[model samples]
Every structure is written in structure tokens, then in C-alpha cells.
Target: MPWAVLRLHRAALAVWGAFLLATIGMLVWEAGINADSVRDRIAACGHDPGLCRIRAVVDYGGTIGWASTLVYYSFFAVAAFAGGALIGRELENGTAQLAWTQSVSPTRWLAATLAVPAVLLVAGGTVFVFVFRWAWAANRDLMGDDWTFNDVFAARGPALVAYGLCALGVGALAGVVLRRSLPALGVACGVMYLINHNLEKSREDLWPTVASGGSGGQFHPESHYWPMHLVETGIVLGVAVVATGAAFWVLRRRTG
Candidate 1:
């Protein structure tokens, strides 16, 4: 059972980590070639060529974008798939019941299963932050030193760390509600993707839902990126807390 959980989460991490590493390679190539073209474009626009935002965004294989994307993607990869399929399948297949009847308690068993994926998820988040920081520092103008550490690093990195940890909680809840893996996967994946996608799409507004901005200057940069992070962090904390509570409830209610 422990081996089953390890294979499930680690495999997912390997798959996603490959993508992240490949993205890094791609960034190095772009920094050498494409960055110059971006520099030209910024110059043409009368913006300072050295401080090209586009190049910065691309530098380090898009560390900023990758930093942000990895958090969401890792959550889905581990939380949605591993929890949805492997662990979910165990319960659905009555394997959990068989294990529970043995010497080990349910809570201990569940905790062990969760450990593999939890470690992988956190590892991924840390790798992304490290890679992004390396890239961001190399191209300060793109990331803009004016940005808060919270905005660039802490927000996405820590939020994702929390999010990946929270996924186990969601899995616990799903385990209690649906005795099968596929249905649980569907519900968790559908909800996670929908919330992440819709909220980010309408980034000018709060996520979990979106809205346009309030009255402000025509070029009000203030109404844009900063507030968006604040809202996003709030949502992350809210969901993490709820998911965690639900997981504990499932364990206690089930006496495992």
C-alpha cells in the first residue's frame, strides 16, 4: 500500500518535473537568441531596450509564468490525479477496507499514502522558485525590482506549497464522500481547474469569481497586478483551511 502511493505521486512528479526542466532548457536558448530580438522591439517602442519586459518574462524559460503555472499545475497533477486515481481507487476497490482491518490504523495508513505525493509537490514548488529567482535576477528589468518579494516569490511559491499540502486534505474528504477513485478525481479535477482557470482569466478581478475594475486612472497599473495577488492569496488560504478541516473530519468521523 505504501509502495502503491509512492509510485502514484512520484510518477506524476517525474512527468510534471520533466516539463518544468524542459521549460528551463527552452529559456536558456531564448535568453541567448530571442532576448536580443525582444531588446530591439522594446527599443522600437521607445522603452529602454535593456529593461525589456518581454525578455524578462521569457528569461529563465519564463520563470515568472513557470513559477505561477507550476503551482497550479502541480496541484492538479498531485491533488487531482494521484488522489483522484490511486488513493481513490484503493477505497473504491475495497483495498482500504482490507488494509484497515489489518494491524495498522486508517489515519496512519492515509498519512503514509499522502507522504509520497506531498513531498514531491513541495519539491516541485521549491525547484520552480529557485529556477525563477535565478532567471529573474539575471533580467531584473523584466520582473521589475519594484515588485514586492511577496508578489514575485512568496505569493506563488508559498501558496503552491500550501496548496499541494492541502490537496491531501481534499483527497481525504473525497475518500470519505465517494468510495471510488474516478468520481473523486472528476469532482476534484473539475472544481480545481474551474476555479483556477476562471479566476486567473478574469485576473483584473478576484478569483473564484471575476469582475472588472472600479473607477480609476485610464492607465491605472494600480488596479491590476498587485490587488490580483492579494485576492489570490486570500483564496488559497481559504481553500487550504477548508480542505484541511474536511480531511480531519473524514478521519475522525470514520474512526481512522
Candidate 2:
């Protein structure tokens, strides 16, 4: 079943591989090469404030920001794929029903449908998190971003993986509930956006923020990164578990 799933979704797997490679390559270039060059140029100024040529910093920061943004929003694509192709299309075309009528049970089919992509998502997401964290941390002076930035915060930690898994579950639920491709796609993406947006807004509330004296607003210190990330991850995974359970329950009711 896993092999069948792999062969069926080989195109998506290829696309994911290409995207992962390209993004990681871009981060490597920016962090290892472009950042170093920018530092060298700035250091060459050597106490001459007017001679400092750091124009490259803007370009470097922008590239990194773009990468972070891509990683941050990647869950939408996962949701869309899960809804429009992985589960919805099969249901819409009667392929899933046909499989269930054969030796494969509905529950097992659904498990195979989710397990393969979930594994790939975890593996790819982990690599992306590590590489993005490295790129973001390298030469912090060249970056205009901080730990508090939305894209940076998620892309640098386990939240990215959690988001992807949540999207997968949400999309699967949407597909099973809707039993159609287009509507499921729209609903899955919309639902994920709502959840992500609300979470992003309320993220600071997840952990106790430290107050800066002298009229500065309360803020999270560097130490808050893990606590906040874990909290959000827990929430997202909770959602995933609920959605997955609902999907299985719905399938059982429909199949029975």
C-alpha cells in the first residue's frame, strides 16, 4: 500500500523534492557566501563610517525573508494537495469506494493515504527547519529580522512541522466530508488560514512575556522561543489529532 501510494503521488513527491532542494540551496548560498561577502565589505570600511558599503545587506535580508515566508506559508500548499489530489480526487472519482470494496478496508486505505505524505512532510519539514534556523542565525547583523518575526519564528522550529501535519489532517477531513476536490481545496486552505491567523495574533499570550522597564512594551526574550513554539505546536497537533479522529469516524459511518 505504501509503495502504491508512492507511485501514485510520484509527481507531488518530485515537486516537493525540487522545492526542498531549491530552498535549502538558496539558504546555503545566502548564509555561507552572500552573508560572508557582506561582512567582509563592511569590515573593510575599518573605522570609516562614510566608507561603509553595506548595500548588500538589504538584498541578503530580502532573500532570507523570502525563504522564511515560503516556509511559513507552505502548509497551505500541503492542505491544498491533500484535499484536491490525495483524498478528494479519489473519493470524487469513486476510486476510494472501489478500493474499500476490495481487500482494502476503508480505515486502512485512509491510513495509507495519510501515512505516506505525513512521513514525507515530517522529513522535509525537519530539514527545512534546521537549514532555515542556521541561515537565520548566521550573521544576525545582516538580517533585519528578529525572533519575534512571524515567518522567522515558525520556520526556525517544530511549529513548521506541526503546521504541515495539521494541514494534512484538516485537508483530509475536508476531503472526506466534502467528497469533492475543488470545494475541499478551498475549505481546507480557508480553515488553515483562520487557525493560523488567530494563533499568530494570540501567540504572545501563550507564554508570559517579560516587561521591559522605562515605558517599553512587554516583549518576549530570546528564551521564550521554545516555550512559545511548543505551546503553538501542541495546539496545532491537538487540532490534527481531532481532525484525524473525525475523519476516521466519518469514514466508518459512511462505509458502514
Candidate 3:
């Protein structure tokens, strides 16, 4: 079952592997090799604005931002793949039903489908989290963004994995319910956009914000990263659980 699933989704796996490798290489090279040069150039400027506007400085920041942004938005692709290719295409083309009629049971088929990608996503996400954390910490002086930045916050923690898993579950549910490819793709991406947008808007409210003295300004401290991250992760996982359950329920109803 696992082998069949792998063979079926080899294209996606290859793309993910390539993306992971490329991103990791970029982060390591920029942080380990290029960062010092960028810092030195900036320091050499010594308050000279024109000299600070060199290519190395811009490239360093641009590379880091590009990698982080790609990592952060990867879930959209995951959701689209899950809905359009992984689940929806199989169901729409009747391959899933044919598989059930063979040795593979419906429940086992669903489990294998979800489990394979879930494991791969977790592994890839963990590597990305650790690598990004190291890069972000190591190149702090070169970074214009902080822990509170959207891409940095997400790419640095387990929330990245959670978002991917949530996307998978939502996409699976859409595929199972709609039993169509393109519509499921659209629905899954649309739903994820809404979830991500709302959560990002309300993230500061997840943890208590520290208030500035006299001025009465309130903002989350850097220490709130984990608390807020875990809270958001829990919420996302809750959605994943619900969506997975609904997918199963809908599958059983249709099959039985």
C-alpha cells in the first residue's frame, strides 16, 4: 500500500525534495558564507548611505526573505496537491473506488494516503524549522525582520508542520466531499487562505501582551513566541483532526 502510494505521488515527492534541498543549501550558504561579507561591507560603510547600498547587502536580505517566504507559503501548494492530485483526482477518476474493490479496504486506503504525506511533511518541516532557526539566529545583525515577523515566526517553529498537516486534512475533506479535482483545489486553497488570514490577524491576542509604561502601548514580547506558537498550532491541529474525521465519515457513508 505504501509503495503504491509512493509510486503514485512520486512527482510531488520529488518536487518537495528538490525544494527542501534548494532552500537548505541557500540558507546554509548565505548564513555560513555570505553573511560575514555582508556584515563587513555594511560595517565598512560606517554611516555612509551610498556605500551601504551594495549588491551583497541586498542579496543577503533578499535571499533570506525569499527562502522564508517560500517556506511559509508552502502549505498552499500542499493543500492544492492534496485536493487536486492526491485525493480528488483518484476519486474523480474512479481509481480510489477500484482500489477498494481490490485488496485495499477503503479505510486502509485513506490511512495510507494521509499517513504517507503526513510523515514526509513532518520530516521536511522539522528540517526547515531547525535550519531556518539557525540561519535566522546566526544572521540576526543582517535581518531587518524579527521573531514577530509572519514568515519568520511560522518557519521557525512546529507551526509550520501544523499548517501543512491542516492543509492536508482540509484538502482531503474537500476532495472526499466534492469528489472533483479543480473545485476541491479551489475550495481547499480558499479555505486555507481564510484560516491563515484570520489567525495572523488575531495572533497577538493569543498571549498576553506587555504594556509600555506611561504611553500604554501593548505588544507581545519575544518570550511569547512559544506560547503564541503552541496556541496557534493547537488550533490548527484541531482543525486538522476535525477535517480528517469528517473525511472518514463522508467516505464511509458514500462507500457503504
Candidate 4:
């Protein structure tokens, strides 16, 4: 059953592998070539406005910024794949039903589908998180990003992996409920977007804000990145668990 699942989703797995490789390559380039060039440019610039305004030096941050943004939002791609390719297409095309009748019980089939992708998602997300954390920290002077930044916060820790797992769960639930590929893809993406958007907005509140001074004081967390991200990760993982359970329950009801 696992082998059949792997065979069916080999294309998706390949695409995921390509994405992982591309992200790793970009991180390596940023940490090596880009970092060195930026350092040289900064040294040359010193206090010279003209040297500081050089295109390569000025644009370095933006170039690497986009790469970080892509890595941060990679969960959306996972959501789309899960909804469209993993579960939805199978249900829409009657492949799932075909498998069910051939010595593969519905629950076991669902387990195989979710488990395989869960492993892949965690592995890929972990790599991105570690690489991104290193790159972001190492190139702090070259970028304008901060711990409070939306993409940076999520990308720096387990929150990124949690988001990917949550997306998978949401996608699976949408696929099972809709039983159609295209609609599930659309709905799952939309739902995940909403969840992410709202969370990004409220993330600061996950941990209490601290005031550093008097009346006109600055308000921020004592530790901005990890604490808030950890809280948000817990929330996202809770959502993933609920969605996965619901998917299993619904599948059992439908098949039984």
C-alpha cells in the first residue's frame, strides 16, 4: 500500500525534491557568494555615498529578501499539492475507491497517504528552517529584516514546519469533504491563506508585550522571535491535529 502510494505520487515527490534543492542552492549562494560580495561592497562604501549607491550593493538585500520570502511561504505550495494531487485527484478520479476494494481498507489507505507526505513535509521544512535561520542571522547587516517581520518570524523556527503540516491537514480535510480536485485545491488554499493571514496579524499577541520605558515608551516583546513563534506553532499544530482527526472520521463515515 505504501509502495502504491509512493508510485502514485512520484511526480509530486519529484517536484518537492526540486523545490528543496532550489531552496538549498539559493541559501548556499546567499551565504557564500552573496555574503562575500555584500561584505566587500560595504568595505568599499565605508562612508562614500557614491560607492554605497552601487547597484549590486544596494540591491543585494532585496534579492536575498525575495528568496527568504519564497522559503517562508512554501507551505502554500504544499497545501495546493495536497489538495489537488495527493487526496483530491484520487477521490475525484475514483482511484481511492478502486484501491479500497483491492485489499486496502479505507483507514489504512488514508493513513498511508497522510503519513508519507507528513514525513516528506517535515523533512523539507526542517531543512528550510535551519538553513534560513543561519542565513538570516549571518547576513543581518545586509538585510533590513527584523525578528518581528512576518516572514522572518515564521521561517526561523518550528513554526514553518507546523504551518506546512497544518496545510496538509487542511488540504486533506478539504479533499475529503469536497471529493473534487479543483474545488478542493481552491478552497484549501483560500482557507490556509485566511488562517495564515489572521495569525500573522495576531502573532505579536501570542506573548505579552513589554514596555521598556515611560509614557511614550517602546512596546515590544523581550524576546521577539522564538517565544511568539513557539506559541503560534502550538496553535497551528493543534489545528493540524483537529483537521487530521476530522478527515479520518469523515472518511470512515463515508466508507462505512
Candidate 5:
């Protein structure tokens, strides 16, 4: 059993989890204490009688929620570092072939290794989502004319998980094909970052929609369906799965 994967995943969560919690706690606390200022700001922005209201408005509620989501995304970086090191380091030390020589087949090895970090990712996501829902519920109506917690939490949350999975897949693929861990780590990290760049570019910039007919009118950014974000996220997860399968097939064939 490649215990390295489990260790890597735990380390990623232990280290990154603390950071994520700290950031969220502070923001939530800030929001709670500063509710008055936040409310005033929201009222000010909402009362504006302007032409073509803006979408990217940040209110206290949005601020609290945004802070949580931003910290949640920091998981991607943690996953890249830990996931890359998982197989990449083994391949670097030239000990990865040792797996093939052992009774454990390549497929089993992949499953065991991948499971470790996958659990960590899920745990982290679960915590984030729970906290996000709470924060959103608390601040929902007070969220402001142009800000939204849904935008901050839902869309970006899944994307972060997909990114982590892709990073691990990158490491595995590199190990199987190149048999060198450091190079694999570098390549995987770089490629995932590049993909993330594109994901960001294509990411829909959504905000609350303006409430119509009212004298002052409610305003929000052009909101999007949260489920639609699954499309790109699924695409990323698909690439990671394909790459992983190919790596396993190639490695097993080589071993046999």
C-alpha cells in the first residue's frame, strides 16, 4: 500500500485546513460585528437612482461569504503541492517501479494513492459548504443590492475540487509516463495552473439581478444557475480521469 498518498493528503488538509478556518472565522466575525456599517452601505447602494445599475457590488454579507470562498479555494494550491509530491516524489527517487515489482498491481496502487487525497478534498469541501450555507443564511436578506453569497460559494467550490483532482491526476500521469517524480510534479503543477487560467477566463462573472418595477429597484449582478458551473467542472474532472486511466494502463502494460 502506497502509504505516501494518505500521508500527503492528511498533511495537505492539516496544514491548509487550519488556514482556511482562520480566514473564514475572521471574516464571519467581522461581518457579525460590523452589521450596522454593512447595512448602511447596502442601503446606500440600493437607494441610488442611476442608469444601468452595476453588478459587482460587495456588501457585508458578500464580504463574509467571499472571504470564506476565497479561503476555500486556497485548497487548490495545497492539493497541488501535496498531490504532486505524492507520486512525483516516488518517481523522483526511482522507487516508483518498486510498486510494479511488488504483488500490488498498478491499478490497485493508483486507487489506494488517489483515495487518500480524495478523502481530504471531500472533507475540506464539506466543511466549506456547511459553513458557507450558514453564513449565507445568516446574511441572505442583508446581502446588498449587487452582491451574492451563491456566486462566491457554489460555483467556485466545485472548481477547487476539480483542480485538486486534476493536479493529482497530473502527478500520476507523469510518474507512469516519465518515471521521474520532480519533473512530473513540475509538469503537473504547471499544466494544472494553465488550465485553471483558462477556467478563470471562461468562468461566468455573475451577480444579483436588479429587482424590476420598484422605485429604487433592487440590483444584483447577472446571476447564473449554480448547476451550470458543473459543466466546466465536469470537463476538468473528465480530463483528470482519462489521464489517470491512461497512466494506469500504460504503467500496468509496462509492468506485465
Candidate 6:
């Protein structure tokens, strides 16, 4: 069953591999070559104290920021693939029915369909998150990012993996409910987008804001960001579990 699943999704696996390689390559370049260049510019500016060479650093930061943005938003692609390729296409073309008749239980088929992609998503997302974290922290002077930034928040920790898992769950639910490729793809993407958007907006509320001075002064300590991120990760993971359970339940009802 695993081999058959692998064979069926070889194209997606290849694409995922290529994306992972490209992201890692970009991070390596940013952390190595671009970081060196930024450091050199900083040193040169310090020595001269006249020519401001900080624009170069900012430009490089912008480039790295764009690359990281793509990685941060990769869950959308995962959701699309899960809906359009993984389950929807199979059900639409009667392939899932064929598999079911070949001594494969509906539950097992659904499990394989979700499990294989979930593993790959976690592996790929974790690698990108760690690499991007290193690259992002390598030269803080070159970056204008903060913990509150959307892409930074999503790309820096286990939240990235959580988002991928949640997307997969939402996609599975959409595919099972719609049982069509295009509609499932569209609905899944939309649902994931909403989930992400809402979460990003309410992320700060996950943890209470620290009031430093008087009633007029309220600021979030940097130390609180990690805890907030963990809380958000838990929320996303909870969503994933619910969606997955709902998908399985729906599949069982439909098949039985």
C-alpha cells in the first residue's frame, strides 16, 4: 500500500523535493555569501563613516525576505495538492473505488492517503523552518523582521509544520466532502486561507499582553512571542486533528 501510494504521488513527491532543495539552497546562499557581503559593507561603512552602504544590505534582506515568504506560504500549495491530486482526483476518476474493491478498507485507504503526505509535509516544512531560522538570525542587522511579522511568525518554528498539517487536514475534509477535484481544490485553498488569516490576526491574543508601566503603557515582551507561537501551534494542531477526524467520520458514513 505504501509503495502504491508512493507510485501514485511520485510527481508531487518530486515537486516537493525540488522545492525543498531550492529553499535550502537559497537559505545557504543568504547565510553564507549574502551575509558575508552585508558584514563587509557594515565594516566598510564603519571605516569610512561617510559612504552609506546600508542600501545593499537592505536589498539583500529584501531578497531573502521574499524567499522566506514563499516558504512560509507553502502550506497553500500543499493544500492544493492534497485536494486536487491526492483525494479529489482519485474519487473523481473512480480510482479510490477501484482501490476499495481490491481488499482495501475505506479507513485504511483514507489513512494512507493522509499519512503519507502528512509525513512528507512535516519533513519538508521542518527543514525549511530550521534553515530559514538560521538564515534569518545570521545577520539581524540586515533584516527588518520582527516576531510579529506574519511571514516571520509562520516560518520560524514548529508553526510552519503545524500549518502544513492543518492544510492537509482541511484539504482532506474538502476532498472527501466535495468528491471532485476542482471544487475541492478551490474550497480547500479558501478554507486554509481563512484559517491562516484569522490565526495571524489573533496570534497576539493567544498570550496576554504585558503591561510594563501604567494603564497607558502596554507592550508585549519579546520573550512572550515564543510562548504565543507555541499556543498558536497548539491551536492549529487542534484544528488539524478535528478536520482529520471529521474526514474519517465522513468517509466512513459515505462508504458504509
The RMSD (Cα, Å) of candidate 6 is 2.0
Model 1: worst 10 consecutive residues (lDDT sum): 216-225
What TM-score against the true fold does each predicted structure earn? 0.66, 0.94, 0.95, 0.92, 0.68, 0.93
lDDT tens string, model 2, 166-213? 999999999999999999999999999999999999999999988899
Where is model 2 poorest over a 10-residue stretch in terms of lDDT?
Answer: 48-57
Give the alpha carbon lDDT tens digit for every residue of 179-247 in model 1. Answer: 677777777766666656665565544523333469533332433544657666567667867875676
lDDT of 4 by residue, 1-256 (tens): 7788789888888888798779778877887677887777667766764656455544865665666678678778888888888889999999999999999999998899989889988988898878877777676667664567777777778888899999999999999999898998998899899999999988777887777766866466536667788889999999999999999999999998
Superior candidate under lDDT, 1 versus 5: 5
Task: For each candidate in turn, give its C-alpha RMSD to the true structure in angstroms.
Answer: 6.2, 1.9, 1.7, 2.0, 6.6, 2.0
Give the 10-residue window scoring lowest on summed lDDT in candidate 4: 49-58
Best by TM-score: 3
lDDT leaderboard ranking = 2, 3, 6, 4, 5, 1
Q: Name the regions of candidate 1 deviating beyond 4 angstroms.
A: 1-4, 7-10, 28-71, 140-156, 197-231
Compared with the true structure, all predictions reach lDDT values of 0.60, 0.90, 0.90, 0.83, 0.60, 0.86
Quote model 5's TM-score: 0.68
User: 142, model 4: CA deviation in Å?
Assistant: 2.1
Residue range with the least summed lDDT across 10 consecutive positions in model 3 = 49-58
Write the residue-wise lDDT of candidate 6 on 79-171 in tens digits: 898888898999999999999999999899999988888888888888888888888888787788567878877788899899989989999
After superposition, candidate 2 runs with Cα above 4 Å error? 43-54
Clashes of 1: 2
The segments of candidate 3 whose C-alpha lies over 4 angstroms from its true place after superposition are 43-58
Q: Report the candidate with higher TM-score, 1 versus 2.
A: 2
Give a tens-digit lDDT track for model 5, residues 111-221: 787777667766666666566556655755555533223346343447556656676676677766766655666676677767666765655432344556757666434
Model 5 spans with C-alpha error above 4 angstroms: 2-4, 7-10, 31-79, 99-102, 140-157, 204-223
Cα deviation at 255, candidate 1, in Å, is 5.0
The digit string of per-residue lDDT tens for model 3 on 158-185 reads 9999999999999999999999999999
